[model samples]
Target: MELSKSGLWGDQGDGTYINPILPGDYSDPDVIGVGSDYYCISSTFHLSPGMIVMHSKDLVNWSSIGHVVDDITQISPKLNYDKMNHHGRGIWAGAIRFHNGKFWVYFCTPDEGFFMSTATNPEGPWEPLQHIWDVAGWDDCCPFWDDDGQGYLATTHFADNYQMHLIKMSNDGKQLLMESDVIFHQYKGSEASKLYKINELYYFFHSEIRVESGNEVRVVMMLRASSLYGPYEEKEILHTHGEELDREPNQGGLVQAPTGEWLFITHHGSCGYLEGRTLSLLPVTWMDGWPIIGEDIDGDGIGEMVWGGKKPIAGYPIVLPNQSDDFKHPKLKHHWEWSHQPRSDKWSLTERPGFLRLHACIPLEIGNFFTVCNVLTQRAMKTAKSEVIVKIDLTGMEDGQEAGICHMGTQYCTLGVCQQGSIKRLKYNDTGTCSDGPIIEGSFLWLKSSWNLDGIHTYAYSLNGEDFQDFGGQYQLNWGFYRGDRVGLYCYNEKTEKGYLDVEWFQYHYLSN
Candidate 1:
């Protein structure tokens, strides 16, 4: 589907919006309302400065605030990306809550147990990750504080032994009291648990991938009770019935407007999306004590997809997440993420003042293209067709140090310039197939990559930043773990760490067919 044509940006600008508020891969979103302010955090698997947190005044327009995991050393040594050990593992789905005049985000790594981080401000200086529980058996945990000041955490056990449990915790949000009561033990692939109190009843929201009519799809599962533990009844309130929405829209958080309007900030999982899972906002109606997302078009209790609708909270100008950067700031832009934790001394924005400099570093062991560390990247939108252009200053590059751009994922494609001593050679590495270009004598070049919505990525280069020529085969985009295509800027040397590359600027333009 043409993402831009389908209104992927969400803001229609007419006091109404489209389905996907976020076109790129901001998956497993959990949001909380702090007065007129709404903050949301997303899953950033294996990316340093993990648990991407953002804030919005009107919920529709959002911007990055900070990250939950700033000191990634607390996770694992393999997160350095040099090892490429944890592809899809680090900081899974989490819950964000505003309590006691503080913002707390609770998340767990599947192998690293439960962790929590808090900040007085959403866009923070979030305190260092508090390793709440160091045992890794369950995930998708949510922290709940009752009226009596008693604290509880709702968690889902691993899929191998699927079960939901409500564990007691200390009011200080520090200690888990061990005491766990099983809530539900029957739903297959039940996860993303959110515990909420509404109308004097405890509501547990989760998603269970179920097989209906021989088709596997995600169904919005909910269970509620009068007490925190036990005797909870289950119901499936939402499902995808239209052919337009091929995947299931589930695994997100519920938001209630100040005016009492309810909306589900959800992510629809497209198993085939190399562009990553997209986020959709759906109006929720409370019927018969059950919250139904989407529109009940067929009069069935189960909700169907709502393509476009009026704004949930209007009266604010359009604001969006960071997309492009010119490398003029003293630090990396909030949109830029390293392939893993980078060697801070190797890359610098202050070194060149206006350009982003990536000092060449030899890999621990050169395996796949992904093994190279400090590759900064941002999400590639599903805009049907898009163009990414970057200016590279190759003057300082030395032997074996290559610097360029690529659409990175499981099976990758790279378009770069490799400098062997003083001779610079242009090349395209489509996964493993190599295509060579003319040996250029210039110390500067312009590189661009354009692709359609179907993921047919094509690379191009220009000597003067004006005349661009396509090079290499059409590299089809692919996924690794839960990640989609990440347009990346990389500089690495397999032989020695003696070279560097300066990215003068980067411009991303989404185009139509």
Candidate 2:
């Protein structure tokens, strides 16, 4: 069913309304409304072709525009050893806006500090990376272009010390005008601060932590000031975990609908064996010069999710691109990203008629999964049944050519073919530990993995597409340190040098009810 028809789209009749727009792994979202259209971008850590930009007409539906970082060579290459510099350090938090007729995006890599890039158009040839601030500990930088043509950058320091600062940018956004200065020292372990100016007051919406023994409270807090550089006054808590109307307090963004209404878009933790993140939306109204969130009519701390608003000027049902892959084309889908930098020549399908070929390169240390450069991955959008079918021609399998399918994140598993001597073997590995499954003598084999909703599933290998055998025991999908998991293909070096895997075709089928 289309997302709108699924009761997901929020329409505000008088041309603009609000909703928890893009319900995906798009965390730390920052959006800007240019003219009547809205454009948003989010963080992509350790994933190549980082900084994904999304577009929408109303606040309900969104579509992918392009990536800010398109070239892997422009960023760090995929490292061989897992413990290199920053393993998956691409773009983290991004702030997009139009300043003085030029489109600008300010973003940061946790270990790389903050930077800005500009483009004439949203889907453009963005300019080369321009260094704005390079302080190691800072991240989640959001920039605001004021009515006076001045720019202000706000960001949070990493948890290493828990600090937050706001700096002034030169009029042209070429450099920082002054050293970083304190804005608010709530020391509440604040991050993801977005500064919004309404009327004569400027408000800072941020997250704060309350410390207690097993009573930790991470809530969304707000502060307002008359001046940008402020002795600001604190306001009531906006929302928190377990609120009936609000999802658990997580990174979020606030945008004013075209009809002058306000809405909040944020993510909530999906608690279960698979801790995937889901997005949520709530309505906001101004009361006594302060923005009232979730409509606290009873003066309770919690807020409730509500529906029906003036339909946004342009409203479309919330829809996501198909996650399943057919592999009928010569190139990978835009949703797939490499773990680290990838050499273009290392993989290709254009020359091979019906196969996707990946050439194994230098073996990086395999202890850590995030640093594996050749792992191609896509986010697990929603918990659903899915499987991948690949036909592999193992005729040229050398000691160094190990190709397989994987579910990647902090933790991962692999299921595919491995050739040893004259014997072709089906291999399954759970968290770097491997075991032999089934064996076929021929050069071609079909591999399949079936994932039930709970993520524990079975793997099957087939010589003929019609018949299959359970190749391994059931395994559970686990997340190591990160919150989300991705599934895709990987080619690892099994020998000393380079080797290759020839995959005739790959298809992903999502079973429907």
Candidate 3:
């Protein structure tokens, strides 16, 4: 089945594929190929199950495998959501490589430091994370293990004079030798450094912003040198070629397909949509020695985006990231990553067996609905005309409680059931403004949140699951932090620890980006 038919992106089953092979807010993607299989990781930021790992057979069709970090609390209390706010920061861009029979992933948190994790399998029981470097403010870290077993790690801290460094490291990537060299320091907003040794040369990839047509175009720059240090040649491989339709595609890793074809995977911040940046796969062609990405139609020695093309490696069909839960599984699906590390005791499926039962123990006090800790979220696509619905049982209402659907972004909007004393009212909260509907009789209601590609959102409620009544004004959803918008199902109380809701099902549908 095509990803659209399955409610997401990937495996169109046909010969051709769409732009974002893996859709939603999967920003700053880095991919690697091992043997006949391929794996990719993306920056999850504050979302738990940080640095999501996905697998593929053909390099185009991919699915969520697991997370690099199992215990996010090990990073910081800010990631816990209930403790402090690390909303805009967690894990940034990371590199994935197979070194010495172990799969290694290296990444950094702006506030914390650099960390590495290894796994025997991409779908992992990954080894516990190692904090390799204890320094802060340095982002974009990629690890390289050389042929003679000389290990090196490259990093870029753009905040400090656009400094890029190459550090010597222990073979196992456990210790970071601080004796480093300032490698490349040119270009404004230079970051997302990735290292590759190919054909007896080291090529460092980074994205830089250059003004063209009065716009900050993010161009991909490749630095190459035969020797590890000194006399490096630089060129821009990928960039935005007057993108009025799409933004500039930059900040991704390069990999060769099993069939010996080299390709560049990248992402660009959207101009119109605010659900974060979406992923794009560009075809790479090697001329002379350098690998040029995308199709060189104008023959300017530069490559632009390839909107649609044949799959790089074609074969078996694949599934997409899971959506639309019926609350019947043994546990919550991997598709669901908590806003932070969840409280665990507050939500359950076995308590009622077939419906998701969420206890409103956390106090919201009319604060931002997007800030609540256990708000279960999945990425909203970077297109118009996508909507989600939930069957919620608003029976166990306590005074000053609310629970329902939300469009969580820079400016969030909510349409849910709120309780005041014995009165059960249907409410919509847009930012801080609260509007209410009459008592939702019969204990259960179906709520829906819909939006177009430009992110104009609308909400409705139905006594029966078949029909719905419009209930809220339009909310223009915008991007938040470093990510796009995400639809969330949340429950919380203000007066005290009381109230709960039974979510029978959650369903979503997408058109395109």
The best candidate by TM-score is 1
Model 3, span 1-513: residue lDDT tens: 222223334445787776767657778889898888888899888887788898888877777778898768777777885763778788888989998899999998888889999999887899998988777788888988788998888888766856788888886788888776556556788888998999998888888788866877778888889977858998877767444544677889899987788987787655335556777787999876777888877888877777667888877776655677899988776667778777788889999998998888664334856557578888877443677889988878789888898877777888998888888889988998889887876787999888765678899989988888999898987788787887878888877778888999998876642
Candidate 3: give its CA RMSD in angstroms. Answer: 2.9
Deviation from native of the Cα of residue 94 in model 2, angstroms: 2.7
Report model 3's TM-score to 2 decimal places. Answer: 0.94
* Candidate 2 lDDT trough over 10 residues, lowest sum: 1-10
> Scored by CA lDDT, what does every candidate get?
0.81, 0.65, 0.79
* Model 3 regions lying over 4 Å from their true place: 1-13, 180-185, 213-215, 241-245, 364-366
Clashing pairs in 1: 384-453
Instruction: Report the CA-based lDDT of candidate 2 relative to the real structure.
Output: 0.65
Selected candidate, larger TM-score, 1 vs 2: 1
Scored against the true structure, residue 48 in model 1 reaches a CA lDDT of 75
Per residue, candidate 2 scores C-alpha lDDT tens digits across 441-483 of: 7877788877755667567878887697776677776543333
Counted clashes in each candidate structure: 1, 16, 7
Better of 2 and 3 by lDDT: 3
TM, every model: 0.96, 0.85, 0.94
